[model samples]
Target: MAIAGASAQSQTYVLDKGWEFSQAGSNEWMSARVPGTVHQDLLDHGRLPDPFYGMNELKVQWVEKEDWLYRTVFTVTADQLKSDAAWLTFEGLDTYADVYLNGSLLLKADNMFVGHKLAVKDVLREGENRLMIRFRSPVEETAPQWDTDGFNYPADNDHSEKRMSVYTRKAPYSYGWDWGIRLATSGIWRPVKLTFCNGAAIDDFFVRQQEVTEQVAKVDNQLEINNVISTPKEAQVKVVYAYGEQADTLTRTVVLQPGKNSLSMPAWIEKPHLWMPNGWGDPVLYTFTATVSVDGKEVASREEAIGLRSIRVVMEDDKDGKSFYFEVNGKPMFAKGSNYIPGDALLPNMTGERYARLFEDIRAANMNMVRVWGGGIYEDDRFYEEADRNGILVWQDFIFACTTYPHDPTFLKRVSEEAVYNMRRLRNHASLAMWCGNNEIYEGMRYWGWKDKYSPVVWKEMTEGYDVLFRQLLPELVAANDPGRFYMHGSPYEANWGRPESWKIADSHNWGTWYGQKPFESLDTEIPRFMSEYGFQAFPEMKTIRMFASPEDYELESPVMNAHQKASIGNFLIKKTMALYYKVPEKFEDLIYAGLILQGQGMRHGIEAHRRHRPYCMGSLPWQLNDSWPVVSWSSIDYYGNWKAMHYQIRRAFAPVLVD
Candidate 1:
């Protein structure tokens, strides 16, 4: 929400409306919406059928393969053009994008996970300015040239057999998921703004509570500023720290450099109040005003809230092989939650209210933690903000998933930049617990027969990328930037990975039910220390299923049903899973209801089983929390935020107290 701004010194104008979008190599443009994807824009103009509808997503397979272009015209007043620090900021551009201002090339963007800006003061005209953005095809752009013979282990992860997601810094889910369409979309997927700045502007507002305790805590603040003026200027860095009624101010005077300067300052609080995650105590937060003033005139002001809590990881090898858990304020916590993927594939369409509702449901269910899965987009600020307010700890993952990646120097450089940019932004949130390198890439490589099948050359390249990206690049960035959080190489990782299930020292994703098609009893046989991902699939409620399928064709194995259930053997898998516990119902609606309850029963039993092994199994975050579309997936909550029977079961399983 606070990326770019404008005033008399700097003024920001919204450029989110009144745009034209056209397929690349086209002569005509159609009315488009900014902060939207090409798929959404086409849907708005009625050229494309609803992808969420049954049998429609399969029909619209060409959307992800072609390129797209967006053009718009904005006006700038003569009075506003007096300042020299004018810029155009794109908060997000999905995958590859090229921008031109009045036919003059301005910027080329690669990563959809990050944002970029260009100084437009020189090229922008006074009366009217024409802006154009051309988005390249993600598939053609991200195709890897490396040898692919032995890397064919996880064969089901292909985005319609392209298998190009690993090479790009975009949302991996866009390529494909069991529940998602392969709409590897293009266009501006976030807010677009044009800002005009005169002299100085604040770039990054970073605030963190460091070395926190009950007696004293240090509040660290950093303000990165860019001074456009050619001369030196004196500025005041002031922080009004407030906790409850009492307030204090710490101010400093410094001479700013001509271009870029960072001012770091710290303040100590006496009798500090520590913040706590859910079920521990009230999550108390202190507010601070980060401001930059020149000669008593406030140029920039940012309000930030911080919770003073010291988080420690107590991981050690004990008689139980090893132990892993998070200690908040010196008290051990058993994390209770699920994995969070993108709420929707069209991210910009997900509003603050929708984001809040998801977390609200989590809070109501007594959930205290959520692992932002590695395959999805780095959830926007609204998601983390809601987590902070709800006292839900976040287990963040770097954007890598079930496949091995190449260790190309250029690709590594792009990844490093993305890491630096995103980590710096995520570090300030009080709810952030740990940085996981990936979801299941490491475990997949070990368990999916990659070690046996991989050629020596492919193995070498894969290991090089793993070491450099996770061990070297990410850890170094975290150490230099945010040392307060712990870094796990990956979930299900053990120091001695030779024995996958023996070293109960880390998190585990037991897919016995879905992938292995094992019975629910398998969850109890070899219990994980921390079950990060284990789930069963179920179709959504009839209200949602009917949106994609017609009532006349409402059979279980109907073409419409198969179209919605994208996972290989998904419908049959659910039928087999249901047959294990209850009689497979005759009617479609009865079958769906039975499947929902069966899935919930399985998950509820797993949660109780994990909790029964209290000290050994410290946490249980199931496979998924919500779905990206109206599909038969492993989400308790469907795309419309409707709670299935599993959502209610989670409320009981994750309750603060349990009774027989």
Candidate 2:
């Protein structure tokens, strides 16, 4: 992915080898891997037991309490040193980290949700160089600050995790989600890379296909070039576009100035092939390459693949009714899918093949859309790439979830930067359907006791923060930066979180079954326009449970089993629901197998019920799609990639065409 510019010498080296790690307070250094975690490294060195083992997580809670340090040394060869600039880049840093290169402070990173790249020429030499990163405890990093009204809201530092994940720019699930392991990781969770490039280089580029017809399509691209040299240079930028076997090139000449220069280009395709979602048609894709050359020699290059399509969110409301649906290629269609979360707690270990396999399972289940929940990372690039190729749509939520966030200037500034970076990063994908503000912040404030917890002044500040962040700042940023795509303020709400008849204007999450203990038949009684979130919990298969439970401790009340089950009443709920459809099981295996069928029947009932409502119920994205840890939850697929009974039932219920 090197960009060719005036100087044809651009080298990228993955700095993934020869690393050492230790607890921040300890000097006992251990071998480390760049793209790994403190837990993985500690387990590798036999310093701790498996957190998944029976009642073992309780023993390893020490890992999250202390900061971790990673140090490494790399050499810049004479050839690489010849380049005019050297840059150090980190695709990811778990949460809060301070980086030092050759004993000079480089940068202090506070967000785990985005990547960072910056110049390091002055810190490098022709020989060996040292790099060190100290990751602070996420709990300490996100501690509630003392303000005029004491702590703004209650610090949600629960017993399991000291970190108030809602206060930090880190994955919320890392701090004990209902269906996850609480192993707050620290380290370079993504690849560390060093690049040597001379003069100008293409930093990033994005393409937007605005309109498409049978014979032609209008596509626009924004290309950004970072020129380090102070003197202007004559640069020729060529863009090559290929569809199937046909390829064509377009070239433009421009003067490259110092700092960062961004430009735009337009391209039209003849006889353009349109992209479609699952079951509608084939998801056609095209390849593209951007190259920068000076004096007729290629200096830098970027190659990528994309799909062509026109999409719009139709929302027309009047006094009587409101219409909210996705129109692709001018055709309104029903959306059937499930909410998505982090596929794995060990994020760096989630490979492209893993994403492909999981998504294939989704397609097999006849789902077309997946909601990337706000509590997790924006997801790795491969996820959107596969969604594009597989004809699946993505509903992305900004990284704001359950808890009320601070309106302090520092927090707002960080969120603003985070939004801008991700908006530019992910706006181009054709599979990206819509943008949502948060998961359930409004519900928490209005109904979940957030208002009761705050004083009058604090409540005013909190409400203002919510409005500014979700209502104003986020939407304005999206409109100014990436137009055309629809941005919903929040789910299960209209205009704001509490507008009357919100279900008619936005999606709804019906949780009567799990929270209210309503009968399994309740899904048929009350429904909404878009049934976005509703689910029944079931344990991971017996095989998955064995990973964390011992054979002798298979009973529901056993310490191993209880320790693994997160929801306080999860087992009771499952047992109670299972009895309605199935006879009481005498043994553990029977209960486990019967639980699968019980969950399947309940979820499939809701799915079918939602689909039966048709235009009245435009979409069905159940509570979740996959699991981050092996425990009883709503996920249809288990941690080991085994499909529970619900997977098959969902496949049938969500069939592209079903006969009633």
Candidate 3:
């Protein structure tokens, strides 16, 4: 094998232009956009209706069941094609996809959460090259596996009749969530790029904070360098950190051999300004640049902004049971915020402006934390970047939610890769406070009466598989990859709503007010150590309601309105729950207003109850902060970015100084 010297450096070309997509067997190819979905492309080409509008979602169900093909022609210059290595990378491939370069198969991708990188040095040409990705239907690809499993795993949130979400590694909410539409999108959902590199390239650059104090902060600037050449080469590594007018530099020389080389350069910053949560202090940040040079000339380099902060989740044994709270800079901090779902059903639409506005809302509300729910995709880098900048903390959950999954070796291997990739990608964020395994799998298995539904042997097998994945595999990965970070097997771990003792320990998801049909006062009565989930649903503002409903569809139970309501008993529950506290309004707009008032009141009671308890109750995050689509769901903010009455009430409740 031949290798290019350091003189070649590295260059990247984005394959985002001149792309087209069509059904797999169809001859028509319309203009397409990379980092977008098939549904989005169809709408762009005027071939599909708006799915979020009244009754249009049902008409677009066929899109997720068919195979789609995407192709793009990109040219490589003669000078660029002479590099030692060329690699093609996809940031995200929705579910099952097969990649081809020119006419040869390049890679088969099965998980949407994991990025794929393929070595394309052998297939390169000096001129134009054809790249095609054939995406199989996630539903069709996983249907057979569900059939062969011989048992129906509990996945109640999957609204499709096939119930095949458990077998696929895509976003669980894409199949269907109570608040989101059932539009399983498939395409190159993220960016695609081709890179030409020389003998070495920077694989990963992690600035791990070893310790943080007012005096000094110690960090290890770890760099993973991949050297493609057969022989060893001497290279100069320089790392520089800059904050305000002050800067620090570290320089070293190392010999890089073939394959991967791990290098860590330990350094310290004196009199560091700590990154603090929303209410504590300013969230100071520093920028760093790492450059690799051969013969004192820069060859490859990486630069990023980072924050130096010490954060940990404190779970200490108390006389009552156990305490669950977050400690930042050695002081216990109460988490005050709401749970976050995917802001849009189609994720690409969550633009930077949207993120900026959302964080502004969070900061204005005096929120210090946000829980990224399990059913959604790992959000884009911009999401965390905004969190880091706003001085907000993030509670991240692995993308397994409200269901049991298969534990076959192949499935576990894919999961392991997904875990490692995400951990490495997100571990450097200052806002990352904890890693939770899943949302409510343990509670569903134990308290949802699975024990009585299946035979003892089958039940044993199911529970064992749960143990292996959550208790063993996930925690072990967190230990190995992201050491010192807080790891919880699942949210509300060892805490079941049925068990009174559960409320005295760890975290809790108190759904008694909604799912249990209890009154809003139950939030005050049945308090837990950490209130992780509790919220009531509200109709969006009338302006948002008009987005999907017309004058004729103004009635609560109208077909168009019901089409927007995905919860089975959503309308009935709202009406019933509202009649108990407030006067049932007659007009459609009044009804929406009344629902928002009731939701706001209910959340206010919960938030006040949690905050009043102080050290006993450490966190209070409602079921959701935003909606996936415009629907009557448990969200403070509507899909159209309208703040419901509940959001304003929440803003008052989460104030640093509460009157209640």
Top model by TM-score, which number?
A: 3
Count of clashing residue pairs in every prediction: 6, 7, 0
Q: Among all windows of ten consecutive residues in candidate 2, which has the lowest summed lDDT?
A: 154-163
The TM-score that candidate 3 achieves is 0.97
Candidate 3's residue-wise lDDT over 341-384, tens digit each? 98888888889999999999888888999999999988898999
Better of 1 and 2 by lDDT: 1
The lDDT values for all models are 0.81, 0.81, 0.88
Error of 2 at 209 (Å): 2.2
| TM-score of structure candidate 1 | 0.95
Q: Which residue runs of candidate 3 sit more than 4 Å off their true CA positions?
A: 1-8
Per residue, candidate 1 scores C-alpha lDDT tens digits across 1-660 of 133454335678879767999998877789997888999988998988998887787767788788899998888889868975787888889979999998799888899888787888889888988999999988777554423432443534565554667777888888678877667788899888888776688787788667788888887788788877888999888888898898999899999889899888888999877788887777878887877777777776677777778888767778877788888887789889998989997888899999999999998888999999988978898898888888899999988888777677878888888887888877878899888887677776666777666778767777777888777888888888777679877776642223455547667777767778888877776576777888988999999887778897688888888878888888888888888889999999999999899989999988988888878888889878998888898898999999989989988999999763
Model 2, runs deviating above 4 Å: 1-8, 144-163, 318-320, 494-502
- By lDDT, the candidates rank as 3, 1, 2
Per-prediction TM-score: 0.95, 0.95, 0.97
What overall lDDT, based on C-alpha atoms, would model 1 receive against the true structure? 0.81
Off by over 4 Å in 1: 1-8, 144-155, 495-500
